[model samples]
Target: MSLQVPRNGKVCVIGSGVAGLTFSYLLNQLRPDVHIDIYEKQERSGGWLNSHHREVNGSKVMLERGPRTLRGKSDGSIVMIDIMRRLGQLSQVQYVGKKSQANRQFLLNGQGRLVEVPKNWTQFAKFVMDPISGGLVRGMAHDLLHCKRLDRKTYEDESVGQLLARRFGSTEIGDRIISGIYHGIYAGDMNEMSSLHTGRRFVEDEMKYGSFVRGMFSGLGAKPSEILSGELMEYNRSIGGQTQHNWTEFARRVKQSAMLGFAGGLEQYPLALRAYLEKQQQVRLRLGQAVASVLPGTGQNVVVNGVHYDHVRSTLNPSAMAAIFPEIQGLQHGDFKSVSVYIMNVYVPGTNLIRDAIAGFGYLVPQRSSQGDGLLGVIFDSVVERNYLNWQTQLPRHQDDCTKMTLMVGGHYLNKGLHLDLHKCLGHVSNHLGVDLAAYNPVTQNLLARDGIPVFDVGFDKKAARVVEECTRLYAGHVTLGGVGFARGPGVPDVVMHELAAVLHA
Candidate 1:
């Protein structure tokens, strides 16, 4: 099917997140003649993937206030790698050589003491075997691993909490662990989340192995020795340049023809895509142009924009586009709430908080242990090898002198709403590290949209599916939606790229 191009056919893309930028890039690559117009609500693009740097004591320290880490696994990760390679920044990609040793995940006991997460099976057994936590774990394990196979069709829509309580005992341990996982990722409640959507792999693995314990032992160890021996070859062939690409270098490489600014922050990603499209004679970008309504046009699609974009020919899959933009009234607009997080970047004079650079990726604060108002996570800026630091050489500075540390605190509903209480959480963290926050110069505090992430509810999949179907039905052979809403994880770029590739091939 040939894409009909007028004397100057224009392609309008909504949103400037990775998905939108990626789709624009892909479309430009495939049909350069087709004018591409990317409209971003934000003043800039890059979405949540953003970084900042500051000079401290004559040394530069880079702080990743948002999305400090990237994953090496997953198909989406491969797409990000490919984009970097194409942009000629593949060599800049670097991975954490050594995993962080901060396994200090704590669960708040009834008394509110912070206890360390179990280190080994022995510790796990002992912890779960306890009278209080054990019964819960056992019950959960039984429900999760020993329960009869669920009807796959009906299971996809089941609530996580309902599934867990029904399959596993609804004990405190199960509840706490489930809550912790949800809080760590979605910052959401399990009862509102779909078990199949969130825990599909876990459920599959359990059902396949007949028990979580057996699954862990057998599945983890079941890798063939021959395949394990070829790990180096496998790693070398993988995208993102040998899986050694660190977050900073990775971001730098992925950002092509993109401007960076602390003012607009993440908004730059989408704005850049808009700017790029505008630069193209064929492409046009319309800002503040909320798509109020959409309807089927003869052998094409019509989009209602502000005065500037009253009516434009949409060269996209009519059906798919229609699914997303169903009805001219904008009834399909999903409700969303915004969240605000304040990132505190501190520069200590001469302390090397991270002895090993590779081992300082970061740590996550499980929700169950957040204690109402607590910091979400802390990324080791010095440890993540980037241009900000000369990690290859030995540091001449002594530990007692000074060092830089970036403390990321507050974002979830509980933490953001109670920002005043974060001072205590920050104090606790500072005291734990024996570092004085007052001593170091505060680099900067960037407040990001707390509602930055979409909340996927129990029926989100169904709604999203309907949107896709409507878009396909309306636009027919034009238009596509790709982003975190369609996919999840730190490797969102990868997913966008993969989806773009698939659409192109199709």
Candidate 2:
């Protein structure tokens, strides 16, 4: 059946990430009469916010092999919360107040001992007073607290490592911490990464206050309640304790809403948006129908599928579609590479291995330590969030059957060959947890693509600008691009929504 809009024009949207889904939802809400069709190559939705549960050794355990948590305080998180509220799922969103065990985080030094991160003034003093580590810590603290600002134009182009080393002076402690953070976040090497892109917050904070320590102290003193209730405090504690939080419960809550789904991992979010549009009477969705080429068309009629598709009457962007159309010549396609990531969700039975809800958000494997067979990090699901626990009690007993453990393995930056060997990786993780996996019934393994994560090289902004300019020239007013690759993090949906809204209105 051919779908028709009452008065609003017809529109087509491409892709199905959070950016795509949020864009479509906003547009539909704004103009319910507007005909909107969303197309996706995948069949399901919820991009990286995917979760799975299975019976492992007679216990009903949940596992998240992908993004297991959302930054509760991020702008993207705000949008997600609003969306959930609109969908009547906000009540399901629960927060587990500060838990002590979640504070433990460790840095795996060359010696293999997990060095706990400093949590309080006492820990900090101890770390600095140690003769062997004191100089590096002091140097880093001084640099992070007092680095001079550079011109904005040059700031974006600098590598994170260079900026840190310059501000703090290259010391073993500083370098190791920087490398660990880089590994944890981007799964990329710190030395080669653009500081302006990845460490913008740190750099900007330092630029504004002249020191991380000062900024932290100032922030703590001013907004004690907000800061204490937020993830920063949890992160600080993790650093001090030398442990990471498991993100499974957090990820599950995000996906539970009908407005959110993850049929095929995180990639499903975009795909689901496409499906919703296709189901609408005012929308049409096309798939496996790559545009072969695009050419200038005049008046209201442009030939598509051997029939003239009205341009003026339709709300869809003809120019945008033409630009991305496969057949279009003379335009540079965006550079992209397929990345394969391996995930292992391990369930550890018989032990209250994780006590704090925040302790298991998981840890990143530094690039420097990539040579070893060790898994990237382990997330204690049951401990990170109480929502994942089967009981209402604060702590699960060691003999309780409900307790489980989840571990995530190699990422795109890691060697892909190593990931295929799940058994080996599982064994390594079991060793790290001081437990045996054989006791667990079903261990879940998933592999997924990390597509559209922008690679900010030396001149990434220029390259991105050129792509935008070319898109504008070729597609004109038709195609629209939105996603993290365009902008990073939770802020992306807002930026894309505003830009697209302006474009639509114009």
Candidate 3:
């Protein structure tokens, strides 16, 4: 479907998350004549990009209740870097140091002890032989040699758990490793989340190339970089980043290791974008203003908050988006699977608790393990970015080595309705990591995010496609829906790329 760009028409964009903001930025750059007005329900922008930085007593601490890091080593990540440069915020990007321990992450074994996850061949062998691994190595061997592909045709989907158990010859491996990764990102149950969403590219390789092991080498066939380069050029032009692009710069940026974040935190991006957009005469930001309803007319005109616009773009979640436009049909609640999550922030005055405990980027607890408080994972913020703890304005001697951590709670565990109190969470941390909270006089904050993350349940792709199609058919040339949740994958960079492509192509 071809979308006709209006010469000088007004457009209303719902939701002020990264998707909406990036789309607005690109649309404004691509067609400066088009008047853009963004309406955000929240008093502040950055939906899940929440970052809290403050000083308590003499210590500086930062609490990232939402997204914390931006990956800088992939094609999607390069899209974000290009956008940052275009916005003149490239200098603000800070990469994790080359030799930093932040590059490492741990996993909780069945014994409730944190163990460094394998990194290289030697580590992998040791990890496999370890008694704590619980036969995962054997499972991998069976999967690599004997497992056959499922009989599903194109467009058919299966749960991550189903796919793993069928191909890997054991449900234990899925519960241990696969579940932890998905839980960390999507806060989803492997038994329900779609394999298509989690590992679609790899699974597609196995279908055609015979095995996932072989697919890793020959998956993209030949000249895969050629396919990626063409897309990158188109995206670069769409965002006004490069008039004449250099493949060398793109390759260098994509190879850069470590994740990047702003000094203030991830929210800096949206906050800066908001500051930038406020100066534009053609852009209007309506903060704290909710779109009461969306009334689509026969043609290209759509009514939002009693104002008529040529086109409306929705960045809201599936259910919330559907609720606003009651006139549309064929949309249902089951079309989207969103999971609620709770974040507990903790700051201890001394590093004894963290240093003496698990090292690296903290650990993830699998569902099969019995870690009290229903903890999913823990991020060692202080270890990840030690500089965040060193405040410039503070007195020199005031800089004390402190441990700051963000503990993730709930997800599928929310169904249990366990005690989510700060005290209880602290106890869980103490028990799991053997950290003495009382010694450090810990400060804590609880953030409850209801329907915070979108889960890619089985057949989610089909449902997502239907939702988009329904919106198009019901409100042709009137409403365009786009966001991270609707992207092919749910990484921050993935969402940015998806929105950029969708909005530009639209």
Best-matching candidate per lDDT: 3
lDDT tens digits, residue span 1-506, model 2: 11222356655545454655665665675567776554555554444545565676576555665665444434344344444444444443433332335435555444333445676778667655543353465676667656565555555567777766666666454445657765555555566666666677767766777666556666653431222223323322322122224233343343332122122223333334455555667666555444433333454333333433322112112223334455433223444322334556655555555434224444444444443553555555555543332212323223353444555444444533543466776665555455565665544656554432334544545554665555445444343345554455323333333334332442
- lDDT for each residue of candidate 3 in 320-377, tens digit (9 for 90 to 100): 6667887666455556657788888888765546764466767887777646567788
lDDT per prediction? 0.49, 0.48, 0.73
Model 1 misplacement above 4 A:
1-9, 55-59, 98-146, 206-211, 224-298, 304-342, 353-360, 385-420, 431-436, 439-444, 474-477, 488-494
> Could you estimate the TM-score for every candidate?
0.71, 0.72, 0.90
The TM-score between candidate 1 and the true structure equals 0.71
User: Which residue runs does candidate 3 get wrong by more than 4 Å?
Assistant: 97-99, 147-155, 216-228, 238-247, 350-352, 387-400, 416-422
The total of clashing pairs for model 1 equals 57
The 10-residue segment of model 3 with minimum total lDDT is 388-397
RMSD of each: 7.6, 9.3, 3.8
Task: Judge candidate 2 at residue 265 and give its lDDT.
Answer: 29
lDDT for position 190 in model 3: 82
